[model samples]
Target chain A: MTSPKDNKSQIWKKDLPKHTFILLVLLLELFPLYMMLQISVKNNVTFNANQWLPITPDKWEWGNFVFGYNLIMPYVANTVFVAVTGTVFTLVFAVFAAYFFARYKMPLSGFLWAVFLLIMLIPGVANIVPLFVLLKNMNLLNTLWALIIVGIAGGQVFAIFILRNFIEDIPKDLFEAAEIDGASHLQQVINVVLPMCAPIIGTLFILEFLGKWNDFLLPLIVLRDQDLFTIGVGLIYLDGEYNKDYGKIMAAFFIASLPLIIIFMFTMKLFVKGLSAGALKG
Target chain B: MAQPISYRKALNEWPLYLLVIPSLVAVLTFSYFPVLSAVYHSFFDWRGGDAKEFIGFDNFTRAFSDEQLRYSFFVIFILVIANVFKMIPSIAVAVLVHRLVSENAQYYYRLLLVLPMIVPGLVTLFIWKFFLDPNFGALNAFLDITGLKTLLIWLDQTFLHWGVFRADAPIAWLSQPKLIIPSLIIWGFPWIGATGVLIFLAGLQSIGTDVYEAAELDGVGPLSKFFYIELPLILTQVRLNLILMVIGTLQGFGLQLLLLGDSGGPEGAGMVPGLWMYNRAFGAGEFGYACAIGLMLFVFILALTWVNNKFIRVQK
Candidate 1:
């Protein structure tokens, strides 16, 4: 009974609140980021005066970025070394375990997989004290090796859980075809499993890399030397040093967060898929 | 014909077992060993050095009796309550974003919502620390610019009569005991947690569209559709997120540690059990007491997780 114009108006009425809500949320989510960007460029004198402004071109001081970058570049490099090595080790161990669990029927496979799940249930903070002592005993304290080993070990359980599901989902025919052609277990994994599990590998790599890069407490506890700090630890040190210098601190914040932001922008789809995949399936 | 592999057959499958060895070794060394050590260390009076004595449940007894540790449990309870309420807005936002008219807009909005996840969590907390600084914080500046500062003072004096604020005084967010918890709650205002949204969205998307159309044909309104369809369907994800959040809040003291430092905030108001464990082991060299605290927390989390699983299964 309603006219086409009336129907159009009703649709608008229904959507108007939804659009408004979304826009408000976008503003709230972006507000601190906008403030960080604005303060990073604003000169110290004008920072308080124009704190609420999105940008101030006339009074901008680009020197903040230069100063912050110089201070944090070494830390960024250290983080990259740690995150990359950690991800590679985690992926290597996790892929092998996942392939074995998915394709091969080894003894006590069910029990082993259950134990991994049980490990996930144990709250991580409970292990911090004991792990600290363990690292200290091995004389690995104050070294990146401590973080790297823990990162790889901690990341593998979740990585294997998700990767096993992904590998199991691969068509059985592909593996059979490879095996019939005389592919050994290792050869079949290399030829069939690795190629089919690329998406998941990419997903776990990004997730684990991001987690290692953002980790604060482990690095703060393990590493004592300023030169060996990760970006998260380095930023805390920067905050203490430049406590009153808002401009410089914000600049450091931007620099510390830049790599992950860049990565997320490029691989956002994979990141989302990874997040949902682990949670939904697990 | 499906028989279990014998020892000889298992030996023949050595390659597969070999592939799992590295992970097994790593888990045993890092994960399992630490837990066992936690249990073993809890019974001793060892500090950092080799001066060890078997205390035999003294650490556990002391932890149970410690007044400060009991206060921390209360603080943790408040934080967990706040966290539960925080999930509501995250779910609402996810549902709203799901109903967006344009597919491109929906994708971009979801991306924008999650963009903050890329920022290091410590940096975000630091930015909030600055934003809540009493003297020159952006929050106060915004209130001043909007004339809300005067309005708030008037309301405080006339209606609420709390007498806590003067017209000229800036609120000390982190320094005051009363305002510390509120400041923690407000730190991530609008609380659009990226993972929560994504999980809920995935749950919603998995529902068939035909159910929605059928509901519409039944003259179901938006509220009815949400309660009757969306709510029940996404309950599994909701339950999962709740369990995760509960576990996370109980185990997490990083934010509290970073914000309050080793002192556990002003008057130890922000002290949670996790931070207490860190302080006991690292700061005070009471490793035995720390281990006891850690074991207790682990058992509590395990019990809570089991109860949650049972409750959710019963609801189904």
Candidate 2:
């Protein structure tokens, strides 16, 4: 093995370059975020003057954020309501479904699992037309429930796929032990499966939340009222309106992004762990 | 492994059925019903409202001969190809991160990489929209500042004969026809997203230290060592990512939809199948035709996925 002293000396040749390269790439990756943050605090005039460099503190336009916050906060509220409700329902259904698949084998088990798995193959882009029609027919056309119900249906899938594997991998005796204590079917799900699978579920929760939060197409199609618009559709509207005002538009983008930032700030560990588990990082 | 619950015993467990039904009904009504409904409507001349006329194979035939649709496929093909090259940077970064001697550096680099992802994807999209704005965009400003715009103009004038880059006017990246696909390709520069890097890193990190030690004993150089050992070892992750990128790139139109509008930029140059489908359904109210386009996309995506699964097994 090489000596630690030699390693320290030659580190300048090899390791230095690697670090510099990584740092450079990291900065590039972070460029958009930098652009968003810097631009958010400037008004139309100052922004018109300098689109590339940071605006000085003297000219910082906190009013842009106030404008953005007033404009999009309702949509933000709508999104939070939709995303949370959608994520919770999606997880509940996914857990129940995954638990069903994992714990038991019935005549229709393969067929049922096939029903779930096959839907994964259907490019969701293809089905949007019909789904839009469906929301209309179901009287969910202009309502937030449209997003909630559809999100529950489409988003549960990856979670179910992951959770099934997880539940199946959980030692069977734990379920048997819970059952001996008179755990009902629901109780076993709550007590036994939930604990063992909490980490995976947390991962699924974040994924579902992010997916719902980012989804604009469904909201665009389903909701007609501007008041009911989610952040995705709302942001598009904001972009259209504020095309001349980069500061306010960037502020809107920054504000729309905060919920997720706050969420991951707490759940970053679980999120990273879950993604790195080689699950539906897609 | 636990024994499978007998069919009879499964029937006895009727209470268990409750858990599966909500999910089942939701899937049936929303997911499966939409597929069935889309298939049914693909053959009709149905508007989004109620008017329907059964026009068997007409939509399909229209799609077959549609020139814009044809152009869209060509554009998507280019995008898919560009995406293949884009996969390299993530792989390279993963390999570099994997090779880092300091654990703390590796951890911090990974943390830095992941931090950008917390930004909502749409927010990122919009920021890029601003970043690509012709007169006001940072890209044009950067090019102007660095004199690359001048160089590009000279090259275009002398050899290329292409007229995209000009010294006087800012390059209209999204609005210009010739630049749309190029803009789409270069939308996310240094496209080393955390999901890609981390997945590849997971695969790379799984490699035992002894393998590297063995390679070191044989005096293997870094480049060949990468090719023969590191690259081959992470083939599974690479293949998985390639398949994902292909499928995603082929099906995606949101970026186009956001950046280029429903008509898909100038001359419809950035139009892909998905955006074409969206245009048909939403723009023209050709729900039936859009469904047909979507089906056609589904078939291609399914075939590619099948081919990837069947023939491209990596040595694990």
Candidate 3:
């Protein structure tokens, strides 16, 4: 907005203080990550010698990554399964619920929509104890299905809320046109709504996926077997074992974060837009 | 808006309910059931099984006098206070990034801020745990390298002595009772949450360029520009983030549970209401008491949110 041609060279100096301050904050923000990467390549001896900085590439030890991979691979798989399954399950339920809410306004339907909206006001913390007991009574304890079921149920409120907004915004003619083409309700949903709300569904999927992935206390309480451990609980156990082996622990940390980072790399644009949208609506 | 259907027509459209039933059933079974059961069970003496006896208000009476539970609230009070200060960095960074002359620089900054978010939150907690390891942790290493350890020792030896920061050993951050709260406070150093910054940035995006130009014409200084223009404009975002953080901190115990154990650090200094509920339920098998605690927290949060809305909304 300023006269850019008048002081083209001054932009750097003008923003120097802001730039320096932001970069300083960024340094602190990224410090732990840098530390994790540095220690991930250093063995015990080298870690002791140079805990201050990363060792040279030639001096780097690669065994930590291999060992970390072998150690946490099962847990990572368990987490990926839970997160993906839960996200899909959440999206499915949410899509159906959202479609009904968006398409109709019968008295009963309106009452039901109010119930769903009120769901947000209920504090989840209060339900933790009873939920645990419910899971227990359902014979769901120590099973990945417990996590998936609970996650799917807990995730419905937000998904339905956001998806309803997206689905309603969609032009009504599309659904009507599909219906005239002899499309059943399900077919209309699949062919018309799904394609139109694909972006929002992607956003919902990523958000719900992250929610399931980072979930700690539920998995910690539900799963008794190390084999059933999600990444969060798995890391806690790994930390207990590898407290001294900073290299392996950091490597495991990196390994656990790999799927999320990869997902983010592909969906960074949607991720940003989604976060902003979430705030605006929230 | 959704189109309206007549009741007679709605009667014929009963099958449409099939689309909504699955999610409704799941939520009712898993979510609503627990909530209703928690309310029902809070008045009974239950051990997380079929055996239960009606205790009326005994659990509530017990929670009112519980020492650890009360102390956990005190601990969270300190944390919530620390978090108010913690929010400053995100706001500042968003403002600074918004002020950047070059759009390209702004994009890179946002990208860099968001990149760290890919590391799951659990991993962040784990890394912070690593960073605070007394022996070889980043904090201690930095202290020693900067000769600040000597300063800490001097402070300990002189008027302000804690005895924990002695010359004989590395500072045990997680173990020391006195340092536990401070350590908790400092867990996410420079706590510029990428999501938080983005939220604030989204708010700042609504500010017009002409506003800044008018301020410049009025000879408004940078600090006043921030205080008078940028901050007030972003107050809604700030208020939203504040409400979220408070509710989050109130319900959160994962950080405490992960860094400090379920017992909540030395002398249980880091214990929070959520963690205490978990400990009581899972640790002591005091399921009834834990439900009471959870209900208590629920009421407390509801009250705080009501207050937040009243306080912030009126100002707006």
Candidate 4:
């Protein structure tokens, strides 16, 4: 019912505030990252003299990256191994458990789901002491397997929660049609349930990967060897050793952050979708 | 109700049970067993060594009477309160982002907001640690350049009457007891993380356009529409976020440990209970006492979660 000119004015009025707010927030969020990048490329002398200046070509010290990479590359590789292995194991177990919970009849299903819910409610900090003891008793301390096993177990509850909901919402007719074609329970799970639940599975995969990759405390406790350190634990060590060397510290931070940033750029939509769906449906 | 199933039916259902066994075993070993162990160890005098004595209720009583533990409780209380207030700005940002008219603009803003999250949390803490360093910190450099350093020192002197800094000296943010908590609170200003905004935006998007159209036809202004419609609809997300923030603050001490170490900074200003528990168990080898502290925190979080559930009923 409005004229085109009036609508145009209203659009301008609405967008001006929105644009200003968004630009301000974007700057605020980017400032720390910009600072980190600037410091990473500066030499020690220049960095000490001018802490706030952006690095020029003459002042840029590419050696900082070399030094940091030499120091922490092994830890980064260790983290990649743990994250991938943990995510695969978590997804495998979660898919089976969620399929069972969602599709098939089981005794004490409600009670078992309640037990999983109780597991979710327990504070993670409470488990650390006992988990440390348990791992030591099993002679798995300082090993990558400890991290992988614990990560899989910790991540399964949330994964199963999401995947169960996703699988349950799949059309019931699909399973019936598969059954009529002589698809066994295992066949239905592999052929129908897995294909239909791919989106949620992908979401859970990224979530679990990110959790394992960025995890600090458990790895700090369980891993004692320098070679076994995750990137997070390595960064703490780097921070301690290079406390006064801002250039090297910032370099370490930048290198440690690169993988996640790359993954996030490619999977931005999925990441957002995963977070929203987890919060809304949880 | 007592009817027996056929063996064939039972055989056919066996795969489903088998499929769930690994997860069951993992949880039973890693999650449930640890919890049981923690509870069992709380009553003992077991350290890391083999020697153990069953000291019933001693650890719990000692924890209750310990002065440092009481101070830690106070510190955690302040942190939780600060975190609760911190959500206001996050919610405001989410509301602003949701109000953007253009879909492309909304998408871009959401992307920018979430982009910061890609930086690992430890990296963020480290960046802040350097950013808040007394000398050569970005914040102090900015303050010096803008002629605000003198003003800040004067304000500190006038309010606290300490005169601890020279006119040219930069403020030691993390080193001073008075400034540590405030520094921690203000570490990430405009504290709207991506998870919070995305969750709030999801809640907002779930509201039907027809509701807003009707409101517009009824001559409701943007503020009224927000308060009467949008805010009410997003309360569910808000409550969920509140519970999460509470649990996170109560259980998380990684930032404190990273920033201040086991000493918890000057005068124990940052000695949260979680960090206390960690230091007691691992640093000092007081495993049983630490377990008692952990169990106490568990009960506190459980009670708070229960209260939130009972009291903060979401609007239909």
Answer with 1 or 4, whichever has the higher DockQ.
Answer: 1
- Interface CA RMSD of each prediction in angstroms: 2.5, 1.7, 1.0, 3.5
Q: What is the C-alpha lDDT of each candidate?
A: 0.85, 0.86, 0.88, 0.85
What TM-score does model 4 achieve against the real structure? Answer: 0.94
Error of 1 at A137 (Å): 0.9
Once superposed on the true structure, which residue ranges of model 4 sit more than 4 Å away at CA? A1-10, A180-182, B1-8, B145-151, B162-168, B207-222
Compare the candidates by lDDT and give the number of the best one: 3
lDDT of 3 by residue, B183-302 (tens): 999899989988899998987887888898899899999999999989987888898888889899989999999999899988998999999999999999989888989999988887
Positional deviation of B84 in candidate 2, in angstroms?
0.4
- Stretches off by above 4 angstroms in model 2 are A1-6, A278-282, B314-316
Candidate 1 chain A, poorest ten consecutive residues by summed lDDT: A47-56
Pairs of residues clashing in candidate 4: none
Candidate 4 C-alpha lDDT tens digits along B1-316: 1124455765676767888889989999999998888899999998956678999999999999987788888888899899998888777778877776667878878888888888898898889888788877767777788988788778877786765445756788889887788788878876777788888888898766688678879999888988998898788889888888889999999988999997688988889999999989999899999999999999899888778768876554
In candidate 3, stretches whose alpha carbon ends up further than 4 angstroms from where it belongs are A1-6, B150-161, B309-311, B314-316
Flag regions of model 1 displaced more than 4 Å: A1-10, A180-182, B1-8, B145-164, B207-219, B314-316
* lDDT of candidate model 1 versus the reference: 0.85
Query: Candidates 2 and 4: which is better by DockQ?
Result: 2
Ranking by DockQ: 3, 2, 1, 4
Give per-residue CA lDDT, model 2, range A119-156, as digits (tens): 87777767888999888888889999999999999886
